[model samples]
Target: MTPDLIILADTVHTLDDRPHHEPIQAVAVSGGVVAAVGSRSDAQSWRQAGTRVVDLGTATLTPGLVDCHIHPVFGLDLTVGVDLSGAGTLEEVRALLRTEAANDGEWLRGWGLNPNAFGTTPMHRHALDDVSGGKPALVRLFDGHSALANSRALDRAGVHGPEEFDQASEVVCDGDGTPTGLLLEAAAMELVQRHMPQESFAERKARLAGLLRDFARSGLTGGHIMDHSEESTALLQALEADGELPLRLRTAPWCMPGSGEAQWKDMARSIGTGGRRWSIEAIKLFVDGTVDNGTAWLYEPDTLGQSTAAFWPRPEDYTAAVRYFASRGIPTATHAIGDAGVHHVLNALESLAETVPADVLRRTVHRIEHIESVPDQLVERFKDAGVVASMQPTHCTHYSLADHSDNWSTRLGPERADRAWRCRDLRDAGVTLGIGSDWPIAPYEPLPIIADSQLRRRSGHPEQQPIAPAQALTALQALEGYTSHAAKAAGLWDVSGSITVGKRADFTAFEMDPLTTAPDEFAASSVLGTFVDGEIQFMLERLG
Candidate 1:
């Protein structure tokens, strides 16, 4: 028999098997689909002379890790921006600004510069203003919930200052009530983002080409992309046309509809995947700001003393919006982070559930992103509602990284913090928790997440308490969070989550047994290769 590709993995984590099944070996692929799986001899039967066989030494192989909550656009933004991730203090930020400004002057692009991510005090906008001097520089607050713009950027964006829009904006004001350069929430940042140059289709194609390579290095061959912008949609079209995309891209394009099912249907249809190189299965919406932003909807009234604001329009208003998509047969993925946010969404979902059929509710797979904080009451409601709790483990571990001081914990209170990003509890409560990286916000790697879930230790926080050490998940559980279960939540169960026969031969090759490795050992383990449809995309070691 002539086969296309044969990979004799040293070990395979066949996640579908109960007893959970350890170390199976050898998989064959043909026509870009997984052909068979069995003993070495059985797999060898398909190994004709032309079959390109890869006997990957002793590396463990499994279905490609699927990150269900990443922003493909963030990766693109990072490639073109001023990066403050390496700067730890105001001085470093200034020097970075100074050096980057001296060398280049094109819209000071930067990302991952969360001063809070370094566990320090938030940098004042004046520090940024002083450095860039006259250039338009924008620094994304570590959390991605807000950003700090220099005086020039504020001017270029035509806002001058946040004081101009206090009704909706939360501009950091000095004692004098003068607009400090810091812009909170959507107030100060929207203008700059609006004015930021759009990536041409060619530039976007090249950016995605590079991003595909970046995906391979990080062990991510499958991701659910929240790329809803027009430029973003066009980029996917270009990649599909050029045949440049090499990962499982499940797109959730943004759609605005009042009620007519035809409107959403036509809109979703307009952004065609062309030939399914990608899938635009769901519609994306944000019901509240992130937990740290003090905007996640809450029911018990924020015990942390911060505002327990719901991140959506009027519940009834968005309820209709959610139902509009539901009626159109499109799955809806919402970003709801707080308990009130949960309740806000639950009430909306239940109201819609009464009109929508049970099986349709099941098929809709409406997911709540972040779900950063959940009260006991909403957990059961979430399970019964059939809502998928789309979580990012890095969000669990790196959450406090976004806080400069202990403000977030103080805001969340210790008890609620314990319940923050509760993976094990959600699983126990029967909530479908799909794990992700929320990358560039955090690295697009799973090891740190595994470390966080198991170790519960934050960088530079040997003294600071972790949000919830008790809520930690085990290694196998964390792995599953990033693998099969994640794939299931992203609506990719039929394709790539586990190494089942007849699925795509997409997978990752690893150096150590993540299941057996010591918690810290996860940091040492590396991705030898990342494969998509049996073709190696990015690899540190050769496939064979």
Candidate 2:
């Protein structure tokens, strides 16, 4: 086949397991798949009159980076207001909220509010009331698992007191049973969210398109979306209608607590449904919530006695749900942060060995997202059961502290806190560990996330003490997390991941060698270009 394009880089890291004695220098693409990978002379032989050859001088090319866990569609709502991810203190949060409240709008909204900023103060409406100018205000916590609605907002939603939920959600009332304005989990947050002003479909579609382009520009060629809905599906389709998506998306629609066989069937039907660059191929479930918000299901209750319950009211039902999907050859990715949550998911997946056909079980891949603080016993079980560990290193580096002062650390106490984000341990145990930013919850930039995986702290902040130094990953492992392991996590290893003959022509070219550069230096380096399906999705003007 005549090649359509040829990408020549200074160093080409195929990252494939197959042994190759020759150093790869060029990759040829035809029909959106890698047609050849060899020396510069070999590429010249394949070059034709119509072929486009681009040389990236001194650039290092590798398999396109893929964030294994992200929520781009959900982020539209989660990031509706001023970004508070940078605020370090309660004063800083209030200052930002006040500035947002001053804007022209009937309601005040903000997101990425760190719970640690509240210090010992309770997450009450009173903190926001003074700054909201009596307007209904809602602020999403950085974890995306909870939100704090100001008094007016609570009254608007008619959340006057405690409420019951099928899932482990709460309205969080005070001693007198009055709502404190803290809403935990999706069910509770939806109560107030439904009342918030809705953005037009056109507006959301534009934002999503912009976000996906940003992903590509940051060196990502694909993402495993952890959340998907009908709206998201439609938005993706609309974006593709205008043009091809900048990055490939493997979406997993959510199957929540109140769902049953019928809902499971609906989600199964969604599988394999998507546009050219996006597809729904997996099911997303939640066993628990975030540790920072006191919603994670831990073996022992957190110091606040809040994170003891599973997101599903009946844990047995969750197991059955997994069996339902596994039997149909559908892969699942569960949001399980705490030890107990991870344990439950592992137990459910392991049960499939007895009930599911051996061939089907082998084909299906199950993943547990955010295994934040599991003990040694649970670490090996991942490899044993063949479960993928989809983790977010930034969740530890950006939110928690080494001294145990952060809310997540303090809640788990010293012992469990010391075990934070065991990336190295899991990898050492022979587990397929895929890393991500969990964007909108944390930053979506792949470079910083890959760096944080090795640094165990903010990449550029060398003065900041590492949260869990022992959990740091090697440079090669960190890159693999976003490449080979990411593909393995999504069950797409055969078609994607590494740069090799017969694989999809997706590649990320960096100005610096990611493997050899120091973590801090790599985090700041530029992405020369990103290609998906043999087409350049993002490239520096100079490169173009």
Candidate 3:
């Protein structure tokens, strides 16, 4: 039988997890699944009139990259406001905000304000007020762990001074006990965010479309969303219903600390798995905050750390939540960054391993997102418990400068800082590590991150030293993180992840072999094409 389509490439890394690698010259696709994979001659025999053939000469093909952690809806919303990503200084951030404020709007919103951009100068509400023109303005820090609100925004949110939170969140205050207009973590940030105007349904759909296109252009065929909102859920459903979704999406609705089993069952039934393209089979929980804001639940207090509280005011509630979800075959991805936070999660999983049924354990798929700082003992625990370590390589490159000078490194001091992002250790210990970009917090391209994962240095910043050079991974190992390991992490290994004959033909074609390319060249490499379910999703140009 003639195949529907044939793809020919100079080289193909199937990432099959075998002991040896083989050269794959062609792949035939029919009904969105790989029908055959062998030499170019085999595909030529199957070709006939009306069968489309795409030849990517000298280009390399691999299974499509999967970002195990991202917030597509939130990232899209960040782009609609003032993007402070490139603003190197606080003055530059203010200038950009001032320019955006000039437009007609009730409130001004912006994102990607890195506290590292401030240098020695402290961030205050007055700085944002100067550009707000008396309008309420809220600009989130790049990490999404904190935000800066102007005086008007603070007043509107009814935040006059420091407010206590059940979680580790905080409303920043001055020496005089006056509100500083900065809110740390979701609990506090939502106080001001609730006052902002809501996005219309049409606007949400447009943003979703824009986000998916961006993902395709970046060589992503699918992603796992870390958090979900009602608006995001509806928008994804609306787009898929309209046959407009371009990438596969699986999401986790946020599960707070105090929520009981009843609430968990309700969320699971109402929002889980809308269709093949959209799913909400997991729940996202925050065990602790980020390192930058000093909110991480550390083993020892950070150097002058302001927060050492767990995200859940009650730690037992977190264990119960995990148990409740795992019992019903739902996964829980806890945002655990600090060593203490990671330990808390590991303890719970270790305890539950004995009681949960083996089949349920296999299907439960519990994972820890951003295991930023962990000891050797916990790395082994991850392997023993069969938990996936969903990590972002760019977190080290984009946030920590070598020599331990960056905010993230400085917070932990030399001893603990050296253990930043134990990617190599985790992989060596047989823990499945899945890579992602954590978009909006960091750049969301797999190529640059792959380069960073291998090199342990920022792509363009050659002057900055490598962070934890010992944690660097091999190119093949890194590729597996996005392909095979990522699929295993998302519980979709049986159907996706590799270019095997029976698997779906989801692939990312590159202009060159990322595994063999020079570090500098690899970071700058562009995608030749992206395919999902045997259909071309994005292509640079037609090949003869």
- Listed in order, each prediction's TM-score against the native is 0.88, 0.99, 0.96
Which tens-of-lDDT digit does each residue in 1-544 have in candidate 2? Answer: 6999999998999999888778898999999999989988898899999999989989999999999989999999999988998888899999999999999998999999999888998888999999998899999999898999999999899889999998999989899999989999999999999998899999999898899989999999999998888899899989989999999999998888888999899889889989998999999999999887888999999998879989999999999999999999999999999899999999999989899999999999999999899999999898999999999999999999999998999999999999999999999999999999899899899999999999999999999999889989999999999999999998989998999899999999999999999999999999999999999999999989
| lDDT tens digits by residue: candidate 3, 98-141 | 99999989998888887888886778898889898778999988
Provide the lowest-lDDT 10-residue window in model 2. 16-25
Per-residue lDDT tens digits of candidate 1, residues 1-544? 4569888766778776544333468888888777877667777677887798878778888788878877777567654566776666666766777777775555775666654443445446677776675778887765676777777776677764345442224666667665566665664567677877767767767877776667768788878876556676677777777764667777786543233456566655744353455667788877667555555666655554655655444456567778877765667788777777778877887777677776766666678787877877888887777778887766665546323244455567776666767777888887667777777677777666666766666533456455566677777777887788787786667776788877877888788877787767765578888788888777774543
| Candidate 2, residue 305: how far the Cα is off, in Å | 2.0
Question: Using TM-score as the measure, which candidate wins?
Answer: 2
How much is 288 displaced in model 3, in angstroms? 0.5
The lDDT of each candidate is: 0.69, 0.93, 0.86
lDDT of 2 at 37: 91
Whole-model alpha-carbon lDDT for candidate 1: 0.69
| Candidates sorted by lDDT, best first | 2, 3, 1
Candidate 1 vs candidate 2: the TM-score winner is 2
List, in order, the clash count of every candidate structure. Answer: 11, 0, 0
Please provide the root mean square deviation of candidate 3 (C-alpha atoms, Å). 1.8
- Judge candidate 1 at residue 331 and give its lDDT: 77
* Backbone clashes, candidate 3: 0
User: What lDDT does model 2 reach?
Assistant: 0.93
